[model samples]
Target: MAKTDKQIAQEVLDAVGGRDNIASIAHCATRLRIMVHDKEKVNQTEVEDIEKVKGAFYNSGQYQIIFGTGTVNKIYDAITGLGVEGKSNEEVKSEGKKQGNAFQRAIRIFGDVFVPIIPVLVATGLFMGLRGVLMNEQILAWMGMTPKDISPNFILFTQVLTDTAFAFLPALVAWSAFKVFGGSPILGIVLGLMLVNPALPNAYAVGNGSAEALKFFGFIPVVGYQGSVLPAFFVGLIGAKFEKALRKRIPDAIDLIVTPFVTLLVMITLGLFAIGPVFHSLETVILTGTKWVLDLPYGIAGLLIGFFQQIIVVTGVHHIFNFMEIQLLEEFKYNEFNPIISAAMTAQGAATVAVGLKTRNKKLKALALPSAFSAFLGITEPAIFGVNLRYFKPFVCGLIGGAVGGFLASLFHLKASGMAITVLPGTLLFIKDIGQLPIYLLVLAVSFAVGFILTWFFGYSDKMAEELKRAK
Candidate 1:
């Protein structure tokens, strides 16, 4: 018999120590996020066994249960209907931040600030890919047109589509960071504009020696922080604190004018002359180190990253890669990290599919199949937590497949035109070059085969599947 949403909600609440134990509740794309007042009172095993619940785990001081997208929304509503007040996602996130340790909090900050900006980059990436298709020599030749035939105005229009987000990325990062840090977002935006003002030498130009940086105090290098991430983030963080401090001191009568005026003046000075140079240099070193890793011989770099990428995801520190990918795109205008991680995700999904095929239990099959499909679409939490990790061996098999796919990706020097999406949808990122799509398909195919084959033969058995069903 199918469980109603209200029934599932009641069971979940009961499993987690009733209404009093829950401090707040929220829902993300796939999970029911709950901040509980008493962790010891909740029965983790029972929660996992609840009908319609895929899996459960505690992360960043919140008890999260995988309910799979739309299902979670229904469950959250039901939970709220049971006399427990529901909080907004932001409020639950704030509670989580307060409960988490320093490192967890920091990672959460990175996610909070960068997540809002991904859509623009994703749209830009798609635009870049579409433009590549439109301007491809082979395609153009077939159309009886040459590169010279394209008008300058059209090229400029393409630049607007493909380059606008990246050229002014610092502003977006700063604006987001300010919101996350509880400062006035407009002030952050203004300060970020100053970082990339036309008067300063462009960072990319300075990097290529096409333009020299202005010498401030005969030592400080002044350049436009175009496409930079860390500098803008730090400036936003500092600017918000500065603005907040000023708000406390300034009287209400003149506060509006004085606060923004002073905040902008001080932040822009620090951002360009101090914060920008320091963080930008640090960002360069990080980028250099990342490049060095990718450049390791015989695809060792890919092997290590591919093998451990999902492991990092399990630990919840994978958000760090967002900034890394951002930096990679900024420095090289290419994202090598995307293909590697995509292979890892594809492998995990494949392992889940294998599990579904091997399982005789209808319940396990029901969870495993959909979870595997989701993994193919680039969301792996359902596969990772709901199926593969539960079996243990399938997860390891997926890691092995990822390591192989990652090695091939590195060997062929496969790079994506963007970040944020991977696996099936990730194909859009490789559309920039005609040769890139085949290599990407090859990576996915090999990853899927290895993951599926290994998990079928060695990683799972009918006995294990029955055990999982019984345990549930």
Candidate 2:
């Protein structure tokens, strides 16, 4: 029999040499991330040898103990003890500053750079999507109205909030990257300002069109690097390294002044000339390759997206698609590909809702209902953790339904005419351009039906049914 969460927690605490050995603890997805004062005190071999422990790491001056899903919080609670160290400590402390292996460092850096900015991005992205839905000509036409009649100020207010973050994204990335690299954040802000400076010639567009624009310093191309990612990350890394090197080499009296100047010059040069082009080229290659691959049999792309969307969301890599959406919006003035993702989101929500309605266990049903609602609102974490993943069959059902919906939408070339409002039934507003909104609705209906039917049929395995009945 599997150990109870409380038993696992206590055992994990014991393996790590008790609560005193730990400085702090946090959880992400399926791991108990812990900070320790002394790595040697924790028995690494023994911890890994434990039945539930997947791995352990000692890096960035912290020891991390990995556990599978459903066990991290219990272990964290046991380690921290009751009524003393609440969950908020996880947010107050810097988990990324701790040490581990190379992969751990990479994961820490990624989380540090992106996690803080997600809520802002999601809120802004969703707002912009909603504006598009409200403003689309077809949507207004269907409602017996016109865009010209809408108040200009109201439109501008919405547009400003939606576009501000994107327009100034390089600054955000630079700030976050600086934090990731352990550098002075002000320097990152300066670098970000230079990227979006209006005076800089647009190197990105120069070769394709204009030939008369003057170059920066007559050698380096003055590319408008707004929203650039790799440039800031690479530059921040170089800056941190240079600062550290300067501190060690210079006399103590002159260290501060010299270190800052030397690091600034080196980092700026590296960012503008080397990192900028390399990142641009890499992004180009990846986008081209993805487009080519996705152009293959439609079913293949649909299958891939359906199966991995939730997994990607869990790992926080879904921002990659958010990046793609921004790129498409900049280049094409709108996006059509996002609707496929919307279909998958809807399917997941439908499955969770079905499970909530069908399950007899009150606790499970309570968990599933809230998760379903969150998923419908374009927040899938609750659903992934609480409903779909708990009963694996629901997740599978959702994936199959999503794939079918995606294929049909692609077959009819049913692009997202505009962004959805809240990823709920409100997204149906974008279907006005399909010329047959009812057909689009029919596809979503079928997807929901599939999820509901499949969950009802296959979700209640013998073991689960027995456990659920007992719980009830």
Q: Put down candidate 1 lDDT per residue, 1-472, tens digits, no spaces.
A: 9889999999998999999999999899989989998999999778877887887877766888988769999999998999889988878878888765678678888988999999888888888888988889998999999999999999999999988898899999999999988899987888788889999999889989999999988999899999999999999999998899999999999998999999998999888888998999899899999999999989888889999999988877689999999888877778998899989999999999999988886767888999899899998888998888877899999999999999989988998988898999999999999899999999999999999999999999879756865885
After the best TM-score superposition of candidate 2, give how far the Cα of residue 239 lies from its true spot, in angstroms: 3.0
Global Cα RMSD, each model: 1.9, 7.3
- For every model shown, what is its TM-score relative to the native structure? 0.95, 0.69
Clashes of each: 0, 7
Q: What are the lDDT scores of the predictions, listed in order?
A: 0.89, 0.63
Clashing pairs in 2: 59-99, 59-100, 60-98, 60-99, 60-100, 61-99, 62-99
Q: Which runs in model 1 stand beyond 4 Å of their true positions?
A: 1-4, 465-472
Compute the lDDT for candidate 1.
Answer: 0.89
